[model samples]
Target: MRAFICAAAFILLAVPAWCGNIRLENKKVRFIFESRHGGLVSMEDLGQRRTISSAGGAPVWEITIGGRKVTGNAFSSFTHRQTAPGRLVMTWKGWPEAKNKDITVTVTVRLREQEALSDWHLAVEGTNGDQVPGIVFPQIGGLQHTTGTNLAVPNWMGELLANPGEQLKKPGAKFEWFYPGHLSMQLVALYDQRGGLYAAADDTAAYRKNLGVQLGADKKLVYYMVNYPDQTPGRQGYSMPYNAVVGAFTGDWISAAELYRQWGEKQSWCRQSRLHGNKVAGWLKSTALWVWNRGTSAEVLEPATDLQQRLGLPVNVLWHWWHGCSYDDGFPEYVPPREGREPFMAAVKKAQAQGVRSLVYMNQIQWGNSTASWKTQHAERYSVKNADGQPASHVYNIFTGKALTNMCIVTDFWKNTYAGLSDTVLNTYGVDGVYMDQTCLTRMCYDPSHGHPLGGGNYWVPNSGRLSDQIRARVRNGKEITLSGEGVGEAWMPYVDAFLALQVSRERYAGVHGWQAIPFFQVVYHPYALAYGNYSSLLTPPYDALWPAEHRPANMLQPLDTAFNRQFLLEQARSFAWGMQPMIANYKPLLATERKEEIDYLLQLARVRNNSLKYLLYGTYRRAPRMAVPEERFPMSRLSIYAGQKDKVTAFEQTYPTIYHSAWSAADGTLGIALASVQQRPYAVDMQLKAADYGLGNSGKIYLVHAAGRRELGSYAGGTVKVRFELAPREVCLVEVTPE
Candidate 1:
């Protein structure tokens, strides 16, 4: 055994004292470890004058062994060394009071040669697979938040805490979400006006783990991604298959996102993805608007058809509640439409014949608690259960609050049944597509009988993916059809044709400050899959109000004013600028008689998208050009339309950039910078674009393209071009650049 650099610094030694803090450095960052307990002592960016890490008071790593939990500080023995330049090796052993002397953990940190970051890895020795739950590595403490500092997390539509330190101190802030599920991406970063410290699990395989962004003592942030070992019995010692990245960057989340994009684009999920292969259905690729409606032919079919003609754009009707059974209380029984089989089917056909893609809504996970099939068909055998043996259940019915059990997709019986249901919707119902709700949701099932791991493994990702494949090959029968889910989960990007980013509405958790919803999802996956929709206001028929008070349009539509209308336009503009196909939810005939200004703007946006399809629809998302514009905040409220519940909701001010701008690049070296006005009056914008930054040469032709027409803005002869323009009231336009 190698002796410590100093005796007392490491252990009692049973001898004279001699020890010192072990320092390891690379060109990008330097790390110091306290030999006494191997805690992270300090970390400093080579370019900055301050330390980004806190004092050496936190454990270097943590793990669960034989159902017993321990940390690096729990070990009585430790050793460390710089095995090579820009690399350090630390080992911890002699834990559990000699009960598991065979257990040992090794921590390795390396400064990447070409990247300004440190690569981390961990290997555990001597443990049966099931005996070890997971390992938490490279834990960083003392991330104190400051002024203008923000924390970026991959949650719904990508969340940004404008003031993270203050926000985390607020009530009801989530500490962590599992990767590729509750957490959309596998990374977290704390950044500000100065620089950022970024951490991510750079595994293309996308191991299941908790990307812990928890609150530490003294109002600090602790970031550690928990990596699970395969739980199969008798498996060998676990070594991290992918490197954990911790690095320093010079900008905001977008800069770190670029670094992640480098690794994300190469995964099988991205490489073989339909978007990357350009295999997205032509109908979806050309689609610019979605009209989400519920109910029979009168409420849905008529309005959906009219909107297509009115907007003069392809429209999709995502129809919900066409079946005879109660919306949330019926499972595996969708035939005999609400109005009748013939009328509903005919409406679907007529809408399709008129070019309105009809997508029926189905919740794949929920099985009504009182459904007959649950007992007669022995559906309990195919449902998910917790470790305590309770079924996973939810109550979404607004009036009744009835519960539904979640079905396990990994089970063979459920998979066959689900696909068979989809087949009926496609063939018998005659819909063009199926919007599979909850497909992107993750569940931790402990039912070993389902032929998958009990919990905390990669079972959910591939099972959900393979089921989509089976539905296409079996249910869809190789036809080009859209399969969509609720939110964007990175693992599902390659499997489904589209994902609905309803979070764009920013109405869910209103009243919460420091919350900013950005299009970080579209930035990463717009090209990989079509993302659209939000729980914006509905346009239900006045006849909807004629229904029972509890089951009426009044339940969905909120008391409105000009401010809310302005907010709606801003949201739709955001969806468009962020590269998402715009969605109008719950459209009813009553809408035709109201909101004329909003309707006109919607039509104009459709035209703009159609004209710039090469860039806005299918191009790559580059960094959005910054606009030092005035901010606008409109009073807003949430509606429980999607959740099928009617109750008091979050109310707050929705903020917007009065003049919005976004940058995109087409495959042919054309850069499209979109600009829109959220105000009722014209807004002027004068900005500069660096040609070479977007891969454009010094000289290029510039044009201003709008839904109505286009006009050349003359040619630029330098690397930077300054363009000045004023957008009309509620205008949506694109500034295009092409090589001369």
Candidate 2:
């Protein structure tokens, strides 16, 4: 399709407006636009000669080298605000009438300080101060197509078509929400005509650059808690048992304390969920444990065996439907066979005994099923209507003798159904949480035949070939309610504590590099981190499954148990722990036993560090990056205590050969260094103190370095200490030597 061009690149409201409608204040500019014609529209930073874009603005804006001069209208002023240092103009442009005649449009942009934190608010009012709704500002040269009615662009065209909604699976599709900044940080929501919502950007590539500043990519913590709807809807004050609860992800964050406060609120619903809130109260500490299951089937019973056999620990189990079932089954209505439930419950009992909680899956909305037939009898309306004004059909339900339609979330009937079902599941069946699925698909429905419940039209709905306002509205409202695939944009942060899953690319550094750029951009919004792997992680195309010994027809990397996969498994475990992001293993049903073991290890690790694993996993810690202490204040050789003057070190353990970079402070600190061993073979390490490493920066003092038993070796360091065995392969010896 040809690009859609707006008659006016930027048009302002002819009425009175304030701060140019920039929500955060002067630090950032807000572009609230509706695209009728789509093409690139550039916002040039005159001083830096830099630019940002919207729509099809990439040709002229995204490229840093030689590019074509953006054709079409010259930029015009919509509104202007005069600030102390400079004048902010809410600007736009219109197609040139004749070769060089100056275009009449000029935007009046205003900048103001954000009332709250680091954010700056910007607003672009019309020359006459009139407000414009649905204004979208693509960075310089972004593609602009004839504006569709939907608010969000379809997933990026890496592989998917421009209109992914029309396709069942958006292949090679990357969905980025409204990011109108140098550092694309905030994720925008797309509200659909069907009265549903979706957070478009939740992955690494999309989140790093928000509102501009380029932060170095480093994995940060992402903690998420799942809060179910009050089975009674508007009513408050009912409680559910802990066992009836559902799924959640675990991780660390830069601002964990504040996030924990927000988590407390989302979980407020759990109070009415019939849970003894006290059980999870200690969740704040590192010792709190939780479980995430790859598939929800009869085999879930194994969770009990694993939980009891191991630590006999308290855990929470998030049971999900098998892959084919997650999409094809009729959501909550598509119950597994009765035979499956018994074993599922038996596993739940096992988890409960081990202090584990189990949460079941609930559909976000019914898709594929015909609304007429299913709605007529399903009693509980849980399906959404499609663009054709009919409920979509199911590929699986038809094959399984359970053809069903999708449900509509906007309808009172559907809302009531959720309350009834949730209440019954929690109270009657003794469940804890409801793991709602597919929240990422919320968008607008343009079927005029049905009454529109979410008044403002769906922003996710498409118009001609572009996004529409109806879809945008649906995205916004959905933010007001639930969290799903939508990433942590500044706008939707409050509603989402974490993401359901994190999908990433295969290349490690590229993936991690993209993630590191988040902090310098936006901090208010955060989402749990997740990445892709053919193994446990969810794969779009079926991946090579790890077969059990009996199932391995041909030799691959088949492990006797899952022990062979330890390297990658441990790395992943450590990554989640270090970056402060939670790990969700989306493995298939056939490999539940192995996946469960890894899950057990992760939960145990999380429990040890007061729920803070970034230090153990990533090792590149910030908050208090460096420290210095006086030698006199140092503790004994076997001591584990704070070394710095601030006493910031909560706990420590003496180990070996750990690489301490120049980042450590040694001014007046301890006179000794700690090392497990220095020999290639089994041998004790002893040395005299030397100040050479610290140079003149350290006070001239010497001390003796003692040695302990040798340990095993690993690939990274290439040597080991003398020891019969090293339970934690990652743990090394502490080399302690003082000044000479």
Give me the candidate number with maximum TM-score: 1
- Model 1 spans with C-alpha error above 4 angstroms: 1-18, 66-68, 128-131, 170-174, 230-237, 475-478, 508-511, 538-559, 642-645, 649-651
The stretch of ten residues in a row with the least summed lDDT in candidate 1 is 9-18
- Expressed as tens digits, the lDDT of each residue in 9-28 for candidate 1 is 32432222125677777666
Candidate 2 stretches greater than 4 Å from native: 1-85, 89-106, 112-135, 141-175, 178-291, 294-298, 322-327, 334-337, 340-350, 367-375, 378-406, 447-499, 503-567, 578-604, 610-728, 732-740
- What TM-score does candidate 2 get on C-alpha atoms? 0.46
Each model's total of backbone clashes:
3, 191
Error of 2 at 622 (Å): 3.6
